[model samples]
Target chain A: MSILDYILGSRKKTANVAKDRLKLILAHEREEGGPDYLPALQEELLTVIAKYIPVDKNNIKVSMERKGDFEVLELNILFPDQH
Target chain B: MSILDYILGSRKKTANVAKDRLKLILAHEREEGGPDYLPALQEELLTVIAKYIPVDKNNIKVSMERKGDFEVLELNILFPDQH
Candidate 1:
């Protein structure tokens, strides 16, 4: 590839990264959580896992189905390769 | 302050920051948790709170005395000014 093509490709990548980050922020805000901070909690959790293993945030979901049992904190990050 | 004083003060601050961070890592590793990932869990949680306000990790502590009740997740960050 030409030098100009490489430069343009890198620029496109930066833009895409920014777009993806913004989209992620929006999605996190939009998601309804059992507690208001559940989304934040999950995001923070995924970061801790990232220190040990690479994970796809989109696929590795943390959901709480019922709150009766002292709150269910189900980290469905069992299948990292599913994504 | 003189330029040398300013520079020296800043250098000392940096050293303290590094020292504090290393001490934290060591403490986290040294502490025992029912689940091995408890330290990681707490650190990740504090980061979420930091998005909105400044926090002193040293002041805030997250600990679970007993885990018999569907796993207790206690976030002791209710007091931000304790530090």
Candidate 2:
């Protein structure tokens, strides 16, 4: 293990891995009924949002939901408040 | 407003809300294929695990997935390492 890993503790790393795996699995599960559009949608959203604001691409999150008969797309992006 | 809320700022609260909503929506989506067994399954799993180890029920997570027609159940539980 690296010095950083040792300092942080292995349990903390395991927790992070679990969290990330959960996120990916959940994202995949939510896209099951759709046409597998998340990758393209995420790319498109990042491209458009980047034009307006300096955002963290890695932090961007997108999900789709079916509400009754309507579909809702949720986009979450993290950007710095100050330049 | 409470002093805790003021000290942390509203944006952090908003971020937490977003994260929580995403988690719930994802959990709901993953349960679409199954017969809505998560609540029961979670309870059962916690009951079983708690018999051996003192676990935080609120921190336990359960997810089911399909892999090549096989079903997989994933469980994550957080417990204090120290007694």
Candidate 3:
């Protein structure tokens, strides 16, 4: 079953609910790739994710690094208290 | 700047930091799409997102639905308390 099927099929059982987590890393575009590509890709991913996940805008945690070829962007969302 | 740059570039300023949120949907694959494709795609996205976002696995909210030709899977992440 696909993720949708899994989620829907198991909705009646709280034990089957999947945890929510997301991570995205972006690298500087190669000379051939162009500098603008990475940023654009990241933006697209965020836009897509935002459209589906319901997050408290105020609680979002984002981190970034600019070390050498490894340009990384990390996002962490801490779910609220659960039963 | 790409998403990584945007997040990393804006790290120092809380206001500049992006909020954390994610959403994913899966549909029944068409004959051309293959029955397994939708599930696989959803799995791939979740795996990628999980690697980047830090969330309380227990609090993750997942919802699913199946209606005729449409099957939908939705994921929502709620961040913990923030300043």
lDDT of 2 by residue, A19-42 (tens): 211121122212223234344544
Model 3 lDDT tens row, B7-43: 3353335433344433333333122222333344455
Residue A80 displacement in candidate 2 (angstroms): 59
| Inter-residue clash pairs, candidate 1 | none
TM-score for each predicted model, relative to the true structure:
0.33, 0.25, 0.34
Question: Cα lDDT of model 3 overall?
Answer: 0.44
Query: Candidate 1 or 2, higher TM-score?
Result: 1
Candidate 3 CAPRI-style tier: incorrect
Best by DockQ: 3
lDDT of 1 by residue, A9-82 (tens): 33334333211110011011111222244445556656765674445666554444332212223353422331
- Distance from true location, Cα of B19 in model 1, Å: 34
Candidate 3's residue-wise lDDT over A1-83, tens digit each? 44444433533364233344333333331222223333444555555555445455554566655554335544554333333
Please report how far candidate 3 places residue A83 from its true position, in Å.
Answer: 49
